[model samples]
Target chain A: MSQDHSLNLKNSHEDPAKATMEGKNKFLGLWFFLGGETVLFASFFATYLSLRESTAGGPTSQELFGLELVFIMTVLLLTSSLTSVYAIYHMKNNNFKKMQLWFGITALLGIAFLACEIYEFAHYIIEYEFTFRSSAFGSAFYTLVGFHGGHVVFGLSWLISLMVRNAKRGLSLYNAPKYNTFAIYWHFIDVVWVFIFTVVYLMGMVS
Target chain B: MTDNTNINKINSYENTRRKEEMKHQVITFVLMIAFTLIAFLVVAAELSRTFVIPFILLLAVVQVGFQFYYFMHMKDKGHEIISSLIFGGIWIAAVTVLTFTTIIWW
Candidate 1:
């Protein structure tokens, strides 16, 4: 029933070192978040793999996939991941202008990637006649990849908000952690796309 | 009064140092992008799906490692316990998925 003095004491003595410690905690917490996201995608992937062959008279991965476009989209997302790194780099250096510039680039690349993905999905649905209801394989495939695309959309929004909010203020201990956390999330999204390219596209095409 | 002035000077110096370290974070970020793009190209080319799939995944895994250790500072001493717990959760999730799929299908 007694109030906790230790917690209050720590808060009262908050120094730069303490701020750094808090940043580390935020980073670790985000990692745990990404871990859960990994499992979420894993389940979708397993389901997709299981149903990959059940084309149900629909076009198969080999029949539908064109490597050239997927390749370009992949490049865009990957580059965005890199740009976000640059943003974070500027963040650490206390260079707010440079951080905003790089984050802007990252967000632009993410949008481009999303556009390509949407186009690709539309092509599949309209041209290839690959609807989610086409088969179990179709359902799982769209669910998994679509979920990732959704994450990209969400990330784009987050990046935009961060950029707009911090456009004038510049980097602070407060915003630096936000930028850092966003980078982690962006990288995690990129990582998931990697698995998707492998398990969903590559494996589907080959086997 | 002298001690207080010294403390402020040291604090400013530390702030500058921290900024420099953050600048170095750019290198790791660029490397992550390069790895990601290459993996994308490899997978997209449809180059020996058998090898490329695992290779691309491996590249991705490496990128994740960079984000964790460098950007996320997983190597920081204070985060050891939390990191282990996170890895533990991933392990459990992996096992559960594998078990369910294998048991039900096979």
Candidate 2:
């Protein structure tokens, strides 16, 4: 094989995402970033936990959170996570078109999840008068969940950019790592949501 | 001819292994959805607060475990450093949560 084994179809490895040094670095770097991201979210969760009951004079978590909506949002995001896995799966098989198609599905689910979130927030502010400034509970609730929403927004932008920028290029070692990195980050966002729905919504309903 | 045959064999073998891995991922996704349903059902059923809280949190933890280890392939080879970093983050997360829950309550 030539020096650029990654460019040689016959010499290419099964996973272009980790076939080169840059790809490996991108993989490791994303995980390292996620480790830090975990701590960042944990702090927000701690704050929310400490102040979740301080409603002062406004609506509380139980009254504000609807199980039906949260369940739908959870399914959307969780399915998006699976779709991303499908994208990565295709990437490994060198099936660029299928990878893009699955990633497109992942983005659609994310957008749907964000739409539900925006609707939830509007319902709170309109129906319950539960603005972020209303109480400690309100502030914590908005900050925690809003932060997650903000991540989804950012992730959507990231995914869209990656898709658009690489649309003409197809799959190559140069860009495979980038897509893989975004998939991992997307999965981590879902991991955060798992904790949020459990601790914030379900626990709030319990008590 | 020999080189072409060799590459073809490796590609087929890798494709089979990857297909097997994908089966596991789909299975994990199904299990995660089931866990989410159970958590929601238990909470919606209005069970004892103390029991339900811990139980749902346990389910969340298990689901996340499946996400990381199965879907993210953290259990795959060459992930030792990544594992250490993730577990370290978890340690910090635990301490942070504990501190806020215990020390800052009003």
Candidate 3:
């Protein structure tokens, strides 16, 4: 079924991702899902902002967040975002191998980012006694940042699955949209992170 | 056949345009990185809170705009409805954040 249009569109269209009816629908539908996700994250952010000061004698964001670690995490995620852009670039250029290679780089960077997050959370729990039940601030912080981490884990899984499933198929209209959709999702992750660093970490240090 | 030659011509032309688009995206990425550095530095420099907070927030907004327009391809054709959907979400997000922050001011 996938190859039905393979002959007609393998190298013909500028963006194979949107060349077909299904691909167009998938692209639009993914954006719609992301729009809803924006609201979902907004709610978490609001909760975090309102309750951030209710530390209940526990450690505060000022005490807990280190600029160095967050800075490193930001670079890793931002570089990964660019790498996914490269992957999509190659995808559009109809170079399957290069596309996979860039996505592989993207995945590696994502893993590194995840590793840094795990280290951060563990340091908090073991060193500072900042558990979710510590106070309102703890709960809000964990929910907002932890939810973002959960998204990273989910995105990694999604990328790996798509790569492995299509390892042998190369570029086809059927799967191009899937890869493009992943890129969109990955960029949204970076967008959320920009806000997190600004509102949570940087502002936490400011005041 | 003549059609074969025509297809090659169009593909090459499109490839050129895509390459130019890639160039712009790379430029966007560089500017975004610069913005991130400025944000961190301003906070690290221990500036006055009155100015620092809003300045950094504005930088964040600009960087996010680059990401949305360049990386997400919202600047490309056929994204009108997608643009509306995103702006709508942002509208709700702003309202919700305002309500929560004001409600719990203590």
Candidate 4:
């Protein structure tokens, strides 16, 4: 066998995303970062739950949240998660084109989610006079969900930059782990949204 | 001739492994979608708030598991660090939620 074949043999035992030491380090570091993010979100959730009922004669969740809209947003974000999985799957298979295509779809879905969120906020502000300053409930609601929307914005920009910078280089030792870590981050966002959908939207609607 | 045969075997093995991985990803994706739909339906049906809240939260918990285990590849070998980090975070989050719900409110 040639030298290239020997190198391939070395990587055969590990995942493509972790074929190198650097990749392993990045993957591990990103997970730790997400762990910190979990506590941050937990603090927000606790505050929101404590303040959720303190509308002070202002509009409450039952009066503000529309199940249909929130449901659509949930579906969009969940589908984006699936698309990102597909992207990483393609990355594993060494198909850069397919990976890019799937990531593009994921970003598009994220954009749609953001648009729906903005519209939902605008509708609340205009129809129900539910600004962030309206009441304690308003303040908590905006902080919790607004923080999530900000994450989506940051993730979308990150994905776009990664795709553009790597558009021509294709997947390699340097970029495979980057894509892999991004996929993990994207999944973490989806996981957080799952809780938001259940705790904030579904629970709020029923309560 | 023996070297060629050995190369072929390695290639086939890699292909088989990839197929297995793809199957797992697809299954996880389908299950996550199903969980989302059930959560929506539970809320839309206007069931008892008590029942719906816990039920939807359980479904969400399952979906999160699928995301972390399958999509994030934490179920694979060599992910112990990630698992520890995530579970530790969960422990802290649970404590925070409990403290708020019990102590602050009560």
Candidate 5:
């Protein structure tokens, strides 16, 4: 343990003044955090996949998922991911104004995506009478996709806060790391959506 | 101190470079959206069940890869170690899901 600490300290010498060791620690810590989040979503995915075939006299993926709407939602979220990339690019360049602009756009896209998702769920519940209580499959499907939607909500809030808090101050070394970390989180969410699209939507529809 | 001044200079240089890179990032972003929309259309159209699902999934995976490597800059800085950790965790989770599915279903 002591040797590891010493090694870390030695390496810290290279970028010592740039980001404090605390910053590195935060980065490392966030990675671990994301690991936990992976497990959480994995469990949800597993449950959804396992219960996927259990239509239970209710709507299955094929019956429920309209490719058109799902496709639109995917486009909205994907565009949001791109906007976030722009935000982070500005962040790296220390272009605070541009970063804020891009971040704001990203947040708006996220909001649009979330609104679509909510409407989709409402359509599911109202039209099909398929809901969390309808069947085990319904429960699993809603829980998995709804959990992701929840994350999008949280991410939008986080983006908004970062944008508002740092708007006037501009990007400092301190705030730069904050935006950097936020970008990491946002991209991770996008990654999970990719898997959800594949396993939950595509596979569910087919199998 | 000279060190502080030098650090400031380096930061300013990085700032300028990042600004220049923003355009490229936006371009990449646009491409990603296009790819995603195309994949969605392919899936929705139900071009061919056997081929289409896998193909769209593959496209989605590629887009995710682009988001990770380019937008997140996972290729730069200390990202290797963190990314590996993430991948490792994913592998384990995947295996666990496979095992559970086999046990429960079979």
Candidate 6:
């Protein structure tokens, strides 16, 4: 009976995030999911790169890309990644309040990124008349970057949902893993953005 | 009394481990910022495309490594599954890019 009591207390006191069998399985499964996501993005990248030069007499990358605005967008998203890191740090410490705070900052930053992207797309359409249907390059550009922007939107919604659903309950073994996996997803999104910034924006500006 | 002591010991160990992890994360974040600055500077300065392109890509590669190993916590124990899977994904990506670029050019 004493052994059973000790075992129960030990389980209760352990890290809630990885304490349960279900949580561990979810964690591992998500990593594999991300692996598949990597391949999906890779194929997109390949397609984009292949068709990048096929402008079909429309605005080319060099004609449309402005470095300053993209630079700001990059900074915002990168800082959001850092804020998410802080959130996870707090999560590890089991500091529910601080974790939520940092995650909130992360969500705000992501929103700012989306806002910048919207403005960027608007500027492209209004100033340059570069629509997705304008040329092959246009299609490739929108599909690649727009896909990433779609992910940012999804990530933001996921984050907000996690925050709202768990606000009253505080951190527990169940929701802790949920938060952790969401963080992993956020980091992957940022990682994809990193590539987009480099291959699409930076390289486009230079070439 | 023994149980209390054991619990305290475990707590202290976890605390130290967490501190070390935080330090690594902060350092990685700083390095990533520096990499970003270098990438921007290379382009803003209008260096030769040949040099600027490769240099910025190299920086990006390093930053990706840091993002995966540090921010994603792939360096921690029991993360071998994640690490292997990600690397496998990368392998496939590399092959796809190579195949497309080569075949299209030919």
Taking all chains together, each candidate's TM-score versus the true structure is: 0.79, 0.98, 0.97, 0.93, 0.84, 0.94
Error of 5 at B67 (Å): 2.1
Which candidate should be chosen as best, given DockQ against the real structure? 2
Total clashing pairs in model 6 = 0
Instruction: Compose the digit string of candidate 3's lDDT tens values, residues A20-84.
Output: 88899999999999999899999999999999999999999889988899999999999999999
CAPRI band for model 5: acceptable
Candidate 4 lDDT tens digits, B10-99: 767877897798888888888888888888888889988778888988999999999889888889888888899999999999999888
Docking quality tier of candidate 1?
acceptable
Candidate 6 lDDT tens digits, A1-207: 244443232334455567777778889989999999999899888888888889999999988998889889988988898899889878767788999999999999999999999999999999999999999889989999999999999999999999999999887766888998888888899898888989998888896
Name the TM-score of candidate 6: 0.94
lDDT at residue B81 of model 4 (Cα atoms): 80
Model 4: docking quality category: medium
Specify the CAPRI tier of model 2: high
lDDT of 5 by residue, B1-106 (tens): 9966776777767666766666767777778778767766666666667887778768876877787777767666767888987787788778868876887798
Query: Candidate 6's error at A65, in angstroms?
Result: 0.9
Candidate 3 local accuracy as lDDT?
A: 0.92
**On a 0 to 100 scale, what is the lDDT of residue A145 in model 6?**
95
Docking class of 3: medium
How much lDDT does each candidate structure score? 0.74, 0.92, 0.92, 0.86, 0.76, 0.86
What's the C-alpha lDDT at position A97 in model 2?
96
Which residue pairs collide, candidate 5?
A93-B18
Instruction: Please state the error at residue B103 of candidate 3 in Å.
Output: 0.7
- Model 5 lDDT, residue B90, Cα: 80
Per-residue lDDT tens digits for candidate 1, residues A41-121, read: 778877877787788988998898877787788778877877776676555445678878998899889989998999999
Please provide, for model 2 over B24-94, each residue's C-alpha lDDT reduced to its tens digit, 9 standing for 90 to 100. 99999999999999999998899888789889999999999999999888999999999999999999999
Residue A86 in model 2: lDDT: 96
Which pairs clash (backbone N, Cα, C closer than 3 Å) in model 4? Answer: none
True-vs-predicted CA distance for residue A65, candidate 5, Å: 1.0
What is the RMSD of candidate 1? Answer: 5.3
